[model samples]
Target: MRLMRKSRRARFWMSVVVAFVILSFLLSIVSYVWAAVDEVFVLSIDGAIDPAVASYIERGFKEAESVGARAVLLEINTPGGAVDSALRIRNRMDESPLQTIVLVKHSALSAGSLIALAGDVLVMRPGSTIGAAEPRWVIPGSEPRPVDAKTLSAWKAEMEGTASAHGRDARIAAGMVDVDMEIEGVKSRGELLTLTAEQARELGMCDAVQGTRQQALKFCGLGSCSQNEVNMGAAEHMARVMTNPLVAGLFLMVGIALLVIEFFTLGWGIPGTLGLICIGLFFGGHLVAGLAGWESVVLFLLGVVLLLLEILVVPGFGIPGIAGLVALGVSVFLAVGSVEQALITLAIAGVGAVLLVILALRFIEKRNYWPRFILMDRQSSQEGYTSRETGYDRYVGQQGEALTVLRPSGTALIDGERLDVVSEGDFVEPGQKVRIVKVEGLRIVVRPEK
Candidate 1:
């Protein structure tokens, strides 16, 4: 009976150990699932939606997917940017496996409005505004104007489609792009549809109106999730600065102006170096933003080479010079990514460069530095600076023989000396006798001997 009791006790302990092991295994699985589903990736778009911004959002979505995040929280506070870039961001949002909870922190106008409606759940902060997405044709030097009819139609349709896809009112979206569109009491006949946070929520455009990011997260059911804020890196920031229209135009203008001044001045100097740096920044920034590529750089370099050939090697502005100008224009156009923008930039830069060159030349001339840059000393007759032989008049009646055939000009041996002579509208052949008729400056006129 003692042995049986001991054996029973041993079996009971073994059963307890097995139950504990099973419970521990189940707990680990539950903990892992909870951790996996509670992760949220947060991204922010606080500026214009350029290529860099689009790339940032794309990377954010990729990282969220990689970490098994349940959703992404995108904070938007922007006026607008390139429509193409906004479309790219929207496409990325649509393709992301993770749900996107967009939080409009301040303003979402123009292209920003398009990207805002791409999220699964959109929440707007209090006092924030959305809409005013009417597409504008904005050239750098000109005032903003309405886009063409085709562009307006297409953009309106795109906005409406995006809204309809998310079960929002499409008419409101259309009103954002088309000023003529009216939604009764929502917007006037000739005005765009810009809604406050409260109005957006009331109109069903916003899923919720949250005052803070935390509240927005709670509205999206990710309040308990661990948030990882993904910030823009140095490269992206630089890209944004370089791709800005004002900055880009300034860089181009300064670069061209400095380079033109350098060309007018003497050898290579600080102006040329600074000019190159400015131009380099312009292209490099566009490259980082994905608006320019290796092809554009290569083309620009080729253009520079051709231009140098025109200035240094070629005697006149012919094919190389014209081709160089065209190549340079094309390279800048490609870098700028828009025809009207590029044209305005080039025009402004060209005019600015001409004016700067004139001013620089005037300053250099006043400083008596003209002799260093150009041949300012002229060989004038009054100054006793003659390019002709002084005693050439002594041989005016001298006889000579033509050394080479000439239609109007040839070399002749006159008075046992070689002289470059010109016939008075007569053809003279080699080994023919001739007479010197006149001597004018460097000219020695000769006639065939009879």
Candidate 2:
């Protein structure tokens, strides 16, 4: 009986140990399963929906899928952005495996309206507006105006295509692009169709109306899911700013202005350094924004190096300087967009820089900034700076033999002494007879003996 009882006790302890092991395994797996909970990712489509915005949204969708998100929500507030960027966003939305839900928090004008339509379900906030999706072309220095008929027709078709793909009324989207489309109830001739939240829902354009973001998500059957908000990094923001035509022009102007100032002044000072930095930012920002690339930057840098060599070592503005200027102009114009845009941006920046520099020189220089930075002290004999002056005036009218071939300036043997001399607009070979004609300070001018 004692042996049986001991055997029973051992079995019971073994069973308890096995149970504990199973429970621990289950507990570990529970955390993993919990971590795989449903997610509703929200990305803020704020400001101008440019290339940067499209890139950010594309990345957000990728991340959402990696974690098996339930749905992707876009919170939009924009007065439109780039047409290409909007189209890219629309393509991405159409291809995404997870459904997209767009919540229009404010205005969805122009490109914004097209992006909002790309979603599986579009919810609008109360009293918010949507539509007015005409394609407007902006020349940098002038006002923005409508695109030409050929371009306008193509844009109208694109809008209609996008709307039709999502089962919305094609005519309604057409009215947004072409003012003369004349939708019977929503729009008339010579007028673009812009709809309020209520009107959008009535026209079958908007899925529903919700006051808050949370309510909108709940309506989409994604209530209680964890919300993942995708935010923009600092670099992205800078890139977006650089994509602006005016901003890009400003960057180029500042860079060029500072560089000019540096060249005119002595030594490589603050202006030169700052100019380089601004130029770098100009290129870097455009590259990040996908407007320019490494090739443009490389070309620009090569041009600058050549120009610097010409200025600091070669003594004149020759091939390198001209090439550098061309390269710089090409690179800058590339960053600012099309020809009209580039011209406008350049004009604005150039005019503004000239005005600002003039104002600074005329009035602002003596105040605080320029006065502190300017080096007023002269380098003279009293200040411990001196030149070699071995009574060079006495050498005038003296005959000499060229010791070194004078490519305008070389050494010559004068009165049994070697002296540094310069020819007056002539090249003299070695062993040639020469006579000193002028002397001022330490400079002694010579001419080949006639």
Candidate 3:
């Protein structure tokens, strides 16, 4: 009986030990898996670089840092973009905490190339080309002119500073900006060279020529590193699309159409409200996108003022209206990237306005021909027509004295009956005797009795 009890106690102790060991092993596995699942955030930059792209990149960096990402890989494939926007993006990248690696999948010419040099590490594909970043202006009707010496020098300094920050050959980076630059022991005699992946590695411009992201990760001492794709959601994607210049231009056209319809209808209602909202959204998007500055806003306001003058003070759509449109067009062009986009927007707005005007005119004509345009329980009395209760049977021939200065519209007293009247083309001073010349549509037309 003593041996049986001792055996039972030993079996219980052994089972406890085995269970503890299994639990410890399972915890170790979970910890290992957690460590291995560390992520690297990716930011893909394709096509022309702009404020939209810059914003996207900046936002991506913030998110990566928030999630404790291991690193950020900026996959670059751009022709170029606005210089100011590029500089802003470069400055942001320089200030970022996470390690930034620019992966040149196909190419990184011009502004794209500048962005790559700003990265902590640059990875390129074997057959990819990079460089030719000289600044040139695309003047209308002429070939692109090389930027002036002063501009070139400033840009070269900026490029060199950015390159040196990332432990790159600053001189080579500067050469990319000034095509006339030549560095000794770097390029063959008189050879205008754009760096290929192999040449970039030889010149220490790129760390490695990798065929795929996996290879890039391995080469960067992250052989076991895992990755998570950082992507924009559906709402973010739609926001980005609406912020585009083309989409904003379309909105402007729709707004103009609504405004034209409201103008012809002679009342402020649904069309006017929709027009105001659309225009507000159009300007708001541009403002948020950083494409439009305060200058554009000021110009747009000035144009509005001029257009009001054309409508109220002037008789025809002459100088004021034309000038207003011109100012508005110039403002819009300056707010966008290029002249082509501006012209496209103008064409669309014009077509939409014409169609809206035609529709409005037809509606007005139909209303004039058809009675009961607006359903009403009672018909309103006509203006300038005397009611039978007034006892003014002989008022049409009786003279009246102007009670107030009739600079187009004021009050008059005829036979002790006060009346609101408007002068026809001439000013009528107070105390002047006036005659009721005509009566039409609630307006009493009066003139000075000669």
Candidate 4:
């Protein structure tokens, strides 16, 4: 009986030990499961769907795929952008292995509409607008005109086909591209169809309507998932600025002006360095954005070299200079890949350079700063000037006041002496500070003092 009692005690202790081990193992498994948090990625794409935006979306998709995300959210808000850029973005989204849900915050017109259709699921905010995917051909110095029937026909077919693939209304999609396409009760002739959020749902184009991105996650059954937002990097912002029409024009003008200044100054200092940087950015940014390929960059470099050779090696504005200008213009046109864009840049730079030169001559020339940098000075006898001012050389750097308005000819008060002076095209008000840039006998060329 004593042996039986000891055996019972041993069995009970063994059972307790086994139970404790099992409980510990279950607790560890539960802890691990709780430690692994769910993550969802939000890819925010706003503004025009240019190459920069397309590149951003591509990078966002790759990053989302790499992280094993629960869902890839496309936060879209744009009016529209380049057709080619939009198509590239659509292709990237279509090829992504991860599920992509397009959440349109505001208007998704034109290219934006097409990209929205590429997603696995389409959604929009209440009262948000979408559709209007018409394609128009733009010509420089004139209003935009419609494309040929064949091109329009092809685009309409493409739009319809994309919608059909997603089980949406093909007729409605085609109507967005062709104004002639009437949607019976929804739209009439001579109008491209744009739909509100509720209209999109009724038309079976959009999947759901949600106000914010969190609501979208909850709608998708991933409400509790942690979110990761993808954003533009420094390089992407630089690319956007480089590609912008206004900014690109400004860059071109700055480049041209700086180079001109460098040539005039002839010392290759700050102006030369700044000029090179502006030109480099114009080429480098476009090159990275896929707008300017290596060929355009090569052509641009060759053109710049030829222009430099003409200036430094030949030392004259001759045939080489003209050829260089042509080459550079052609390269810029190719780099931007459009005639209209190229003309815009050229016009802005041309006009901007003139204005800049005028301002520099007016405001900066008075400081005698140009003379410090330039090696030569001009002498005009017709304006009443001599090579050597016998007694007026002492007044060369003297500061004085304009006693009368100078419209290339004025009177000045210098050292309490009334003297007749000639201004250099800068209108100087009476009582304004004046500096003597050149003195020839009685003709003193004065400018507004810095």
Scored by lDDT, the top model is 1
* Prediction RMSDs, each to the true structure: 10.0, 6.5, 8.5, 14.4
- Candidate with maximal TM-score: 1
Query: lDDT of each structure?
Result: 0.87, 0.82, 0.76, 0.82
Q: Considering TM-score, which of the candidate structures 1 and 3 is the better prediction for this target?
A: 1
The residue ranges of model 2 lying beyond 4 angstroms of the native Cα positions read 1-37, 139-142, 310-318, 351-450
In model 1, the runs with Cα more than 4 Å from the true position are 1-37, 264-267, 369-450
lDDT by residue (371-419, candidate 1, tens digit) is: 8766677778899876756779999898989997656776889988998
What's model 4's TM-score? 0.69
- Residue 13 of model 3: what lDDT? 99
**Top-down lDDT ranking:** 1, 2, 4, 3
Q: Model 4: which ten-residue window has the lowest total lDDT? A: 31-40
> lDDT for model 4, on a 0 to 1 scale?
0.82
> Of 1 and 2, which scores higher on TM-score?
1
Model 2: how large is the Cα RMSD against the reference?
A: 6.5
For model 2, where is the 10-residue window of minimal lDDT? Answer: 364-373
- Pitting candidate 3 against candidate 4, the one with the higher lDDT is 4
TM-score against native, each model:
0.74, 0.73, 0.64, 0.69
